[model samples]
Target: MTGVTLAKAVKKYGDVQVIHDVDLSIRDGEFCVFVGPSGCGKSTLLRMIAGLEETSSGQIHIGDRDVTGLDAADRGVAMVFQSYALYPHMTVEENMGFGLKMNGHPKAAIKAKVDEASRILKLDDYLKRKPKALSGGQRQRVAIGRAIVRGPEVFLFDEPLSNLDAELRVDMRVEIARLHKEIGATMIYVTHDQVEAMTLADKIVVLRAGRVEQVGSPMDLYADPDNRFVAGFIGSPSMNFLKGQVAGGVIVVPALENRRVRTSVVLPKEGATVLVGIRPQHLTVEAGDSSLILELRERLGGVSYDYLRSSTGEKIIVETRGDEALPEGTAVTLDFDDTKAYFFDGQSEQRLR
Candidate 1:
């Protein structure tokens, strides 16, 4: 029930550094998520906080204690990894109580904690079952239950649901969210899945190449990203980018059949190339005698994403509702509110406000 703080935290191995100076603060009882693509140092940063990885410099404080040099077991943090590291021979109850048992806690006390955690995770019925006897979701719940029984001040999860199938992943997401709500413990979750981060995090830390890109609430990052990397990485289907050239205070997009888009944001110098970004939801398409072709249409129940490609091979995804299908070869024209378009510097890929 305490917050975690990182002050200019850095991690290194001999000569190469994997985690840069990362400054983050996870509020008390907050669900903070570290999210980015693979090898982005989200997991490395999480391990640094869990004391699994040594901090090369700076300080990590779990509440008021500087746990930078503490052993993993002494850090007061429990980490559930991408894999459910369960003992194949132990029953669910035994696995949940193993840590306390090893720590020399009384049998009665261990049982009480195990029972309470099992009740929270809805694993009371499967307590007698071994790992081999349980489904993927059950095994993951057992893993989480194991962490809960230890009663750590902070819980760290490194993609705990990645092993589950699509259906089970959704179910476990709900289960984990509910568990956090019930226990109200400070949790730090790491995942490459943006959907998981968007759905679960109270605050999200977006990382790339060992650097902290941006940190904010889900919608805050979505609606207002500091750079093109964050803007493209944080949303589903991702935001579409079209190249444009500044001319007479307007952007001319060749992908849109040389259409001109005017924006209120200050423009770059004349003839400077810029990136015009528009989310799929903001783009509307209509059948017309234009070079943009409807390459494919994916029907996903209530929503459909119409894939379009221009003469220059620039691809765009137009998200639409309903099950209607547009012919693959249909020529289309793209329409979007000029106000909704975001302009970014083509060179730096940074947002131009």
Candidate 2:
């Protein structure tokens, strides 16, 4: 069964159309993540799914039921926002069971559900405390506990860990992952953080300016992006695009000696301008058949970044795990794994071969 489906989804705010036509399907029990930069419409899309925003055109389905026109509460989905919207006056147990009480659930049933959610979220000890007494992570967990008590068919999280510090964020991320595993419920998470998307998603939906750029597993998007935008967006430090020309069935870029260094990117004709992309981790400061000229290395503790200048003046970054020092002004030769290089048409910014 599909947990959610959006067909030709679009959103328009006055004269500006935010979301273009987007089609997506998330499978049952899968943890899907929607990720993009600010104002890219990821959060807008999530809100549309939650019934907080009306879609200008398209259909939204949750577990075989069409929810395009439904109210937020009628959609049978639970949402955890970035801010833990707990009532300051209410205790943790009261906040967790508030929705159930408002819906006229029996007191005993509400208590049972709250207790179960508290146990799952490690909030059993804080059940009597107000929101002011809890830490950021604990308060966020209470927000999540509120969702858990509803036992919805689907879970929607909009940057739920964004309020915590880095260490707490990591801890909450693990908790969310574990919660998904234990509940076996379909979840959709929205975030701008690439690390969160890469680590948590079973499938990633990459968005740009309200349009869907690519949808795939984390590694699939990382290893084989459909275009320059996706190739550049998926990894940390980003992929390096070196300016080169496609000639003689090979990609030719200049070496430090001003000689043409060739690689295995096949071209249909000679002298066709193309862009070559390689991940920072894929390049090494070692001489090989496919060497690039590296300069201006930056060291930051355990990780070091090498600034590489191609023959055509395109600058690329090469990241290494160890803190090895290389001369700043001296030219170092870098070898890229041919198998990892991505070829794109220079004009269209689209993947070629």
The TM-scores of all predictions, comma-separated, are 0.98, 0.92
Cα lDDT of model 2 by residue, 179-214, tens digit: 988888999999999889999999999999999999
Model 1 ranges off by over 4 Å: none
Q: Pick the candidate with the highest lDDT.
A: 1
lDDT digits (tens) for residues 272-345 of candidate 1? 99999999999999899999999899988899999999998889999999656778899999999999988899
Cα distance off (Å), candidate 2, residue 7: 1.0
Model 2: per-residue Cα lDDT at residue 188: 98
**Lowest-scoring 10 consecutive residues by lDDT in candidate 2?**
254-263
- What's model 1's overall lDDT? 0.94
Model 2, global lDDT? 0.87
Candidate 2: residue 37 Cα off by (Å): 1.3
